[model samples]
Target chain A: MALWKNGAFVDDAWREIAEGEDPPPAGHVILPLDWWEQERDAFEGSNAPLGLRVAPGVPIERFARDINRFALIELVFPKFGDGRAFSMARLLRERHGFRGELRATGDVLIDQIQMMARCGFDTFQISDATTERLLRERGAPAYKRFYQPGATPEAPVDSRPWARRPG
Target chain B: MYRYDEFDAAFVADRVSAFRDQVSRRLSGDMTEEQFRPHRLMNGLYLQLHAYMLRVAVPYGTLNARQMHKLAHIARVYDKGFGHFTTRQNIQYNWPALSDVPAILDELASVEMHAIQTSGNCIRNVTADHFAGAAADEIEDPRPYAEILRQWSSIHPEFTFLPRKFKIAVNGADWDRAAIQVHDIGYQIVRNEAGEVGFAVYVGGGLGRTPMIARKLRDFLPKADLLAYTQAIVRVYNLEGRRDNKYKARIKILVHEKGVDPMREAVEAEFAAASREFISLPASEIARIKSYFAPPALQARAACDAYEARRQTDPRFAAFAANNVHPHRVAGHGVVTISLKPIGGVPGDATAAQMDAVADLAARYGHDEIRVSHEQNLVLPHVALDDLPAIYDELAANGLATANAGLISDIIACPGLDYCALATARSIPIAQRISERFGEGERARDIGELKIKISGCINACGHHHVGHIGILGLERKGVETYQITLGGSGDETCSLGTLTGPGFSSEEVVDAIERIVNVYMSVRTDRSEDFLAAYRRVGMQPFKEALYETSKGADI
Candidate 1:
């Protein structure tokens, strides 16, 4: 049985669909490679970032220009400590400036969610919904940006006290 | 000793509150051991074998009297009434409750002290020459630059979650007392011919299972680009360093595997990109940091002549004066190294009362200048020559006047298996026994300048590999066996020791060390010839023959 499936992230669903499986309502949903080609024109340029989830070690830098035209970049972490995804996220954010939803797709542990968030992850998709409770295990923020808001500073200037200074 | 301005204060206050929240969550089961581990490690809290050990960052081994008193207070109330000074110049408290960590940090914050980044995979408390500001041959005080590195590496983005923990040592003197070569990256501040300050950069030196000396990656890097340049190096390591095995995750292994040329090119490429962005090294900030390390006004005194005559008269004081007193950079002044490694005592363990006595001496006879060496010795810099007699008298009363600085009796030992939960076998008792054997012996002088380092485990907490005679305790089939290694060093040319034949039991280990010392005495070219030089001369033949029963008369 398949352990994980975010319609926005899953390219393969070997099992039967769940009872309350929701379609792509707000964000981009994934389609298999063959299915993607079959439904190519259905993916709108306007509704962009139809995140085509890919496996690890794929150099996304070559497709940087096309990838930015998307609403989200759903990169997969094959396992805990894979680290290749970290470079991918950093390249997208710092180098390519991919703005909208950058979600961690597969095998990413809840323990590493905070680190993922700190590394510019906006959304997390767990593999096993049965063990989804594992997501709130480490440094899970009870309230978003409550006490030390902007503590996860993406840049040094953002962490600086002079961040509010007039140009 | 970077003073906490409002920004630093708020940052620490917020960080403390965040840690406090994390602790509560862990207690309430919102956070598991796995999740709470990194959070706790980031705050310098560790779950050791016993309870909890808090490693506090004594930035570059520089702390004021107020901070020392606060540390003493923590030791008295929260811990076992003593603090162990580590080889990396940090202080470790063996016992503290998990619940009281926040409160302890609150106490630390009152004195401008902290446990921030003391552990975890971050730029650890940047270490430097303990005698930095007042050393006789120092080119410049490296503390200001160390302070800069500390601020930059603390919670640094993109570099925090590194492959493993990183350590950096800086030195400004020609002699590398800071052990710069053994650090992950070493920086030697030097001025170019054009009167511009830069760095002689070295990469990948570390001591563990694999001890390797760093290679010079850059001849000179401009002062303005120091931070950016460091970031570049870390970035290159972060991008390409191995993550398959935890043991091989250090930058040293990475540098060794990939070779220096490629790593240098990658770092330079990153540096070239980072150079466009200024790190804001302003003259005012430099001046501000320099002001914190104010120098003491020295005066001329003729106590040298009086002390010389007394040295010929009193044998005890003369012995102490000869070993303990060091030449100060200023005229008529001398730096005194108070040996904490007394006979049959823990090497670096200092009680609260001893700390108070040192503080008193600092405030009185000295210029309120107290420094802790990497070798776990307390230094009273800028002591007037005339005040040596009074200072010696005061120290003698405090049980700290051990005349064994750089001598055979000055042993460097960690809180081995006896205290450290991670240890598999005992190391302190072995040291205690060795000290007892040579406690009041004339043999100590006959076999001079020996550094016997004993680590209970391979983690090298006692820095076993760097010792001239390294004793590493290991568990062999549930029995404790001590492994002896030879010729390891921590200087500019660092190399891991080669194991010498079979392991010895705890009882036999001390005899093994004594035999080794005895062998050195027998074959040494002269009294001036130290333990390492003699060991290099005869190899490990005498030591092996003396240690093993089968090799009692064996050939090398």
Candidate 2:
């Protein structure tokens, strides 16, 4: 497994705790949604950075109030075709105003990285080594001209009022 | 008729290069078939039963002579020397090798065309009335708005992965030539009491396993809010449409389940929240696109005496002039429909030579503009009446002169089991057989505007649900069978056809159609009443009784 952040592969410091496992004492750690729901008080004032891994079918609104408390949010894809996480990412960034690191994990592919990036996923955890290498080398072969305005505030460069302005 | 600017050109080039890379990765085993299927489909490449089928979009059914010529060239070079014009205003090559797809796309890009979003769950090609600018009754041309939609929907990031494919159609006339009511989103251009242009929007109409007629969502939406309103509807559908089952994933299903009122409320809420600065089109941009679709300047001329004399003398020319020519907004011009459904031939297939000849004819007399109708025919939308004789002669020589534009022989059919993996039975052969049964020119003219649409399966790709005589083909007990429906129409007064009786075998289906036609002819009050008119006047009882009794060996 490789973790890509801010345009390059980097070390993954966060340890994702399995079910029924004790929380780590020192370093940053991520807890599954169910475990975090059951044990919300244990990580109230920890020094290490707190992260949450939100899976599909877990109502994102349940964590709306506490979204600012976490430093990182890992949105799981489960499969590339199941795109519930993409919507979740947009909601977290646009609606909830989560200014923390938004990461995409599980079954992320090279072809989908551009769209994932547009949906506000700043970091990606890819299990496939070949896809990781491709992303590291070419950085998602995407069109520079876009048609839709996404979570980002930048206007499309081809059409509309913003494009007509003098540089 | 909108030509691509530099931005549009570079955008299409970028898409082609990206698809080229995707194809290379698929061939090199970097991506599995499961992963590559959606990507290729987004590029309009489908793995059909025999080979890869490529559907090239003709935006809003408009094309120029150069584009048509390039299509003919592609057919000659990469395909099987022929192409099938589809009901979605696209041309599909039934036999293209996967390896040659990139080259084919490169060829298309030369002519300012690409197959983006032609088959994916994203917004497909935005279709409009075939006779948009040339129609005598049009309030305004819908192509400019359709072009705006084409640009907006192309490569939309959030909408590319929708639950199911989405279709939008626009019509600028009161007669509904574009079949607007049966699309996912139907926009009918209208003028308010104060003489301001806007749109009457309809939502949720579709045909598949579950057929539905769209309901009016808004009586009038201002023209400036077109893109913003549409974006809101799509956003709501993307967030709420069911993804558990592919069959029930269309926005029509979601609209049906949620009811129209709730759906409208949700869409309105989304529309209210959408940022106007990001979604609304500027007036300058609208004017820029509208300038491209302005009708060509013409020197008005009187009716040609020579053409009238020829029509009076030549029976074949008279028949063609009667059925194939449509009224044009310009006085001396007419819209000529080039029938792809020649008697006993495939419904929409045209050879490369035929395509080239049509292009030549269009360049000579039709202002270099062509259109592909949803009925699977081509149109020279701006042909001068004086040049009809020469155009007809060239079309006759090239096997493109079938004078059955709205007659019984102009049947609509899907590429069924013969080509499509989703079809249960063959539809093209059935259409061919029906056309042959009523091949007589006089009888076809007398039958008068009978639209027989056929679909091979429940998907209703051929729009069988809205045909005057709809045919559904299914396999029953190791044999192909067809069920008939009556009195369906895809017009302003749209209605789903009713099933007449039990299914019939392929061999018996044509004769059954003959019996139904005979019943209509006998019971019709006068010659002026067409088949659909008579069917609507008298309900389905007489036709149903006649069909079942004829099957039981009853006398006329």
Candidate 3:
């Protein structure tokens, strides 16, 4: 899988461990939510950075208490049209106040990257070659006007006087 | 009419460019059809049975003369010389080449219009009362709030890929002209005893294979909390609405299964937890939007001698005045509905020439404004009472003065198998036949206010579920069969129609409708009762016996 971050494809430093695999003692690692929940105490002494991979429809509220333990949280979209991850992303950032890097993985199309970014995903895992190529070339088009605020800071107040947000 | 600011213009231009690029990618095979389908639908391009159909948003059905002229140009240049006005108060062009859609989007943007969210799973166009600013009984102009919702819902990042499409309607008048009860979300602009304006919010109402009346969610929501409250509701549905079954994916099903109380609790909890400051509108912004929709300048005057003389002299003009002209907020002005449903004509289909005429009339005598009604008619919302004769003459010249605004012949019919891919049978032909059967002026006027709605299929695009006389066409054993339903209403007293009995073949359906109407005519207490009121009083047994008992007796 290719990782895209900060508007370009980049080499991923975090290694995702499968359910049965053992975690390294000192490297950055990502683990599935179920696996991490079952084996979280085993990595107590390790100083390695931890990340959680959450599948779509998994209640993010369940992990809210332990949210600060991870450096990154990856939200999965099992398919292109399933939007459960979007609400989860917003909840994680806005409601839980998770300041960690949020990533989107699985079925990440070029057309949806901007919305994913707006909903608080800082990184995307692009598996489709066409999407990857398109992102590498033209980049996502940014709309100049937004009517609602999201995880992205949209306003200190513009000329249009509705819902002007303060930091 | 809300004019696009520089930011709004830039937003639409960017979207057009993005769509152009997406179309280019599809042409080059860089994107597959499955991947491109949602993108195209988001821009209101649908691949119908024969060709591509492009649905354009007429936001809250308010348009200026220039925009109407642009639509006429699009119909003449890009489509098949005519456009179909939809029940949602939008317009659809039945034919357009796939390669030409990007250019069409560019044309639409030039007029400050785009098809964004007109289709797809995202929130569709926000509709409002067609007589919003002009209605005498309106509590407030609903278009301002509709425009606010339109902007907030446009390309809404989180709600775009929802489980199913969403529809919202706002009613400002006491009469419920916009059919708020049958929408996914309905807002009734109301005033409290404290004299503060707010909304009575309704949720989870829709018409489709499973019809539902929206339940009241909030007795009164402050005007400022509109966006924030709506966001919370959509967010909850995005997370919890069923995705397994396409047929049961609407918010109605979610509300049905979870029950209204639980759904309300969930939405209220979400609303309570949401950052309301970032989403709800400030008072200044509401005033700013409201200014754009301020009622036109009109001064009340004494009755015009010319208008009185014309009405007294010409029977046609008198009929037009009685049927077509509606009471405006101002005494000297009136609301005129220009019917697209001509006798023996396809419902809602307006030729390019007729569109240009409407635009011209709007510019000259209608306060430079036009409104497309959800009932598939164009409304001149601010017409001078004295100008009725001239306007009627102009409309007659253009074949638009039908004088059947709420009469029996004014039918709502969706483009069924003739154009739609999902339709099981043809709807336009049935509508045409019914209108022809009831074309006689005195007969139709005698029949009085009967709303006949025909849907090509159970999707209810024609809103057959809420029609006073509803016809649902289906395919059975390789033949077209239609089911009739009665007493459905889309007004303030909203109710879903009950099926009269078994289905009839396409050939027998029109006759069945006549039989039903004949029964209504015989059993009605008087002409004052109308079809729905009479049906309510007499019940379906009379009509059912008139239909099936006679057929059973024939068999015997």
For candidate 2, write residues B122-206 as lDDT tens digits.
Answer: 8999999999999999999999999888887887766777878999999999889999889999999999999988899999999
- The DockQ assigned to candidate 3 is 0.64
- Candidate numbers, best DockQ first, in rank order: 3, 2, 1
Q: Using TM-score, give the best candidate's number.
A: 3
Between candidates 1 and 3, the TM-score winner: 3
lDDT tens digits by residue: candidate 3, B250-271: 9999999999999999999999
How much lDDT does each candidate structure score? 0.73, 0.87, 0.90
Candidate 1 ranges with C-alpha deviation above 4 Å: A1-27, A30-48, A52-69, A75-91, A97-101, A104-167, B193-195, B275-280, B300-312, B545-556
Residue by residue across B1-556, what tens digits does model 1's lDDT show? Answer: 4577756766677678888987998999977897688778988988887778999888898777777777788888988898887787778898999998999999888877789888887779899988787778877888888887887776654566677888999998877778888889999988888887778999998877777789899988876666768877887776677777878999999999999998898888767754333354666666677777767778666557767666788777787777877777887778888887888988888887787788788878776667788888888877877678788888889898888787766878878777787788888888888888886345665566777788888878778888887889999999999998888777655656768888889878887877777777888999888878778778876777666755653454
- Please say which candidate is ahead in DockQ: 2 or 3: 3
Model 3: how far residue B295 lies from native, Å = 0.8
Point to the candidate with the largest lDDT. 3
DockQ numbers for every candidate?
0.14, 0.42, 0.64
iRMS per model, in Å, is: 5.8, 2.4, 1.7
Name the weakest run of 10 consecutive residues (lDDT summed) in model 3 chain B: B547-556
TM-score of chain B of 3: 0.98
**Backbone clashes in model 1, listed as residue pairs:** A49-A70, A49-A71
Candidate 1 chain B, poorest ten consecutive residues by summed lDDT = B273-282
